[model samples]
Target: MDFASLMTKEISKAKPSDTKDKKETGSNNKYQRRADVEAARIAAYNAEQEKLQREREEKAALKRKHEEDELERRREREEKKRKLAEESRKKREAEEEAAERQRRKRLGLPELPPRASEEGTPVPEEEDIDDEELIKKLRELNEPATLFAETHKARLKRYRKLVKRSLTPQLSNGPIPTTLELVPEKDMKIPAKIPKDIDPESRKFLFRQLASYFTMLLEEWAIALAKRDTSVKESFSGRQAFNAMVQSRDNMRPLFKKFETGDIDHTVLEAIVEIVHCAQERRYVDANDGYLRLSIGKAAWPIGVTMVGIHERSAREKLHESDNKAHIMSDEVTRKYLQSIKRCLSFAQVRWPPDDLLQLMG
Candidate 1:
């Protein structure tokens, strides 16, 4: 073979290999470009997510700030309202004091002394009694525990005066002044039992008499309550008591109607008799307790029944007491009547705030 021909063959083989290498290089460049594009897309997506997260955090922070601001504004408004109310109350009290003083001056009465604590010297801390303790002491002395529009300081001062008055007896032969005068209760008898064979007209007349008697008793109770002092006679407390009494009188109308019709149950009749008798005797505490029994009933005790084991099943029924009063409120009509009676008792309690007279005697 010629030398030139052999050189040509080698060159041709080299040419094919070079072309193949160029194609592979182009493919690698294409793959690298695709990879770069994918990485850029992922970075953009991450940046968008980060931006959204930041925006959400900013909104949450702003919302919290708004709520905090609103709460602070509400507190400020309430505080302002309280301050205004306090100012108004003080102004009213001052005006009332001035008017009272002017009235006293016009009457040519001696100038009222300043309040104990209002004098140049403050009351000794040691002498300051808790309001509850002061109320209890006042009750023990048979004095009214509280008066309408009376402050704790005034109450304490009054209590001290009462204590001093009691401890120091007057050497002069003058009777001690008392705010409350005991009024004797008028005598009244409740029938032991309603006659089972009584005619409807007789029953109606009897119930009407009983209702009139009950009303009279309540009226007497109010008169006694208002005998405390001039201030008490016109006080809101006294008004409340009178209003409660009026409501109670209204409540008893339906009950008396039932009694007249002979539709009242025996338990109800017994309860009414007991309640009226207690009121008549001024055993208000007992009367209130009786009313509670009539209203709620004695079906279940304040103490709940204990669960018995299977072995003690026979003793389960024995655990509770058998009571006729349990079935007193058998029907809805009876329940309504009792509920009304309960309100009447509440009125009586308010009118004559029960004293522990029985306990004291025992």
Candidate 2:
């Protein structure tokens, strides 16, 4: 009994100490849990902050790239605009230069130097050259060494004029005179004696040359007509004359075709020469009359039909006019040629005054 009682007392004393130790352990555990929760919260907040910072950096970098691209596009546009403007300027300058050259040529002046050559040395003035050098230059230009009764200043002036004239560009064949002489009737007429062995090409070339001279004569006649004092009331006649000339040129095409085939007609050539000669001499009345005669012959009937017994005896006794008509004009190809010549005659009669009255009118 005594031993059991003592053991029970000892257990009762150990129970309080066990209870205190359990309480302390529980408090320590609770403190450790609080500290762990705080540490985890701090780590999560730091991670969130780092993520936000990275997003901000990406946004700033993207904005900077976009700005750089925009700037590059703007620069490209400006460069293209500058290039177009420069090209337009160069084209305009070239056209203006060409117009200036044409104007100078028309005015009978020396052409301006090309843009590339403008920077080169300029031509020396007449005053800059001495007498000996001037004489040498004159010889080179094939000009007279000196003029009779000419002073030094006068000689230099003459040299300058000659040099300037030489500077003008020459035609490939030669310089064409401003005023060309009228083609002679003999030249206009086809040759009487033809070479038997002449080539077709040579004959055609000869015909073309003759046609060109004919055209030149017409141009000279037109120039003379322009120089004359004409009335404004005759403008309609002038227009009609111009139309007739255009039609005549077209009509001549058939004649040219015939000539090309070596079918030479001297009668037609003589008629044309007569008309051209009259026009060149300013004898428009005679020219018009000749044109009418060539266009319409004096024959009453084109077909050879004599007056019958039903006709009056006086008609039978009447003498027939000469049969020198160009029957070729009645052909289908040349029918329109006569018509155009007739129209020209009609206009010429109204437009040109008589030779006697021309001087008074002028």
Question: Highest TM-score: which candidate?
Answer: 1
The TM-score of predicted model 1 comes to: 0.34
lDDT of each: 0.67, 0.63
Task: State how far residue 111 of model 2 sits from its true place (Å).
Answer: 73
Backbone clashes for every candidate come to 0, 0
Stretches of candidate 1 above 4 Å error?
1-188, 193-205, 221-235, 281-289, 301-356, 359-362
RMSD in order of candidates:
25.0, 25.3
Per-residue CA lDDT of candidate 1, range 1-362, in tens? 89999999999989988999999998887666768889999999999999999999999999999999999999999999999999998899889888889999999988867645445575679988888988999999999999999988889889989988987733321111212122223434556456779786655555654555555545655566667787775889977766765655555556655644567766667777777767655677677677777776655443564664656544455436555345434666556556656665555555555465561111
lDDT tens digits, residues 1-362, model 2? 69999999999999999999999998887666768889999999999999999999999999999999999999999999999998999899999999999999999999898675545444467346787988898898888888888866777778888878877743221111212222454555544334557686656655654454445544544564566556732688776655556666577566545544557565565565566556545566666666666766555553455656785644443245545564445687767755654444444444554566542211
How far out, in Å, is residue 61 in model 1?
82
State, as a TM-score between 0 and 1, how close model 2 is to the true structure. 0.31
Please give each candidate's TM-score: 0.34, 0.31
